[model samples]
Target: MPASRNKKNLQVQRSDHTTIWYTVSGPAEGPTLVLIHGWACNRGDFDAVTDHLPANYRVLAIDLAEHGESRSTRDVWTMEEFARDVAAVLEAESVDTAVVAGHSLGGAVAVEVGRLLPDNVSHVVALDSLTYLSLFPAQSQEQTAAMVHMFREDFAAGVRGLVEGGSPAGFDSALKNSYFEKMVAVRQPAGLRSIEGLVHWDMDAALRETKQPITVFAVRAFATQEAIDRYGDRFDIVLVDLGSHHFPVEAPEGTAKLLASVTTE
Candidate 1:
């Protein structure tokens, strides 16, 4: 994996003992790009992607609360709370303008971040996120209960289900196992609570409040036409033949180019 050059690791302390660990690189005055990783993943996943990004662009790869080196004792795990974690970073760094990009669950956070900082975030990007109607939309009472029960009954199995859902047909078994292992290892209560928060998230409400232009880079094999028809008017959904849901890791250069396309414009 290619490593980003001149990377500096930093942390911001938020209320309730929450600490967000992030990496910053490139000139401080350059156009800003904030990279948020998906659930159960960390900022390190974007190390290669950052390496491939334009050298003059300022990049910040963040590990959301309790996901990586960042630790939190807070009880709230809602997407809005997660967005505050990113906001804290922006406030700490004094970033006035930025293109916020997130992968999977991070995509949801990106939307919330845009809502929270209406003036600061110029655009929102979702890497293989938001298009999944099953996951993105808020579920009914019964649906939310059942989904939460499924994960509560057997957490590892729930994690496995997510991994399987993201892996398209003929995906490498060893690779799948790698993802499973890494995801299943996510810190305890936060791991389970975050899933609950995601299923309960009101993406439509967030979209309505967020005024920024949104773009989604979806996996060609996994994206459903139904999703396109539903969100096409709202999001600029572009399909790509990336490896899997975790394509940012599999195809960093391509991911960087896609992100650059948005930031450069």
Candidate 2:
């Protein structure tokens, strides 16, 4: 394993009255790589991945408001609002340009971030995200209602269902349980509201407005043909054999390589 470098933790306040927490590492002059963690996950998820990245790449791992060390009192937990949290961090760090990469829900937020700051964001990368039909493509009112109803009725069961749904066949039972426990324990109100926000998010509209090149590293097991057909022309969907939806955690070096591939191009 590559030796990890020193990381500087920082915080910035966004216009929406949310405090954003982030970590910075690597060379100051290196090309910036902004990492966004998945729903209910914090920036710490990328700690090992950052170590595997080239020392010349400036890395910024951010905690979306109400996730990780960041906190927010705002009622709106939409993807656009989450993107604003990222935008605020970039502004605070004075990052002129970057390759914004996100996992799961963070992937939707990355697209929003690119849309929100087209001038500053050169490329948008999605890791095991945006491939799930239920989570992307803007759900119908009836679909959204049913999904939200399930979560509202039994949040723990709903979260466990999500974990089970994402885990590949024959995956380690212990690992699956660990993931379930962490995700199920997400901070209240934000956790539930964020799911609601994702269900209601208009990904098609966002894609139409955002003009950045999107590279999706989708887990082969979960990459549906419908999603590929719908987004194939728009996004470069690369089917990967990495472990589960949380491949970055399981294969940080491979994930780092995928992320670095676009940054160098």
Q: Write the per-residue lDDT of candidate 1 for residues 131-158, one digit (tens) a residue.
A: 9888889989999999899999998899
Worst 10 residues of 1 by lDDT: 1-10
- TM-scores of the models, in the given order? 0.98, 0.98
Regions of model 2 farther than 4 Å from truth: none
True lDDT of residue 114, candidate 2: 97
The alpha-carbon lDDT assigned to residue 180 of candidate 1 equals 95
Error of 1 at 24 (Å): 0.4
Error of 2 at 118 (Å): 0.9
lDDT string, candidate 2, 84-107, tens digits: 999989999899999999999999
Q: Once model 2 is optimally superposed onto the true structure by TM-score, how far is the C-alpha of residue 109 displaced, in angstroms?
A: 0.2
**Alpha carbon lDDT at 40, candidate 1:** 98
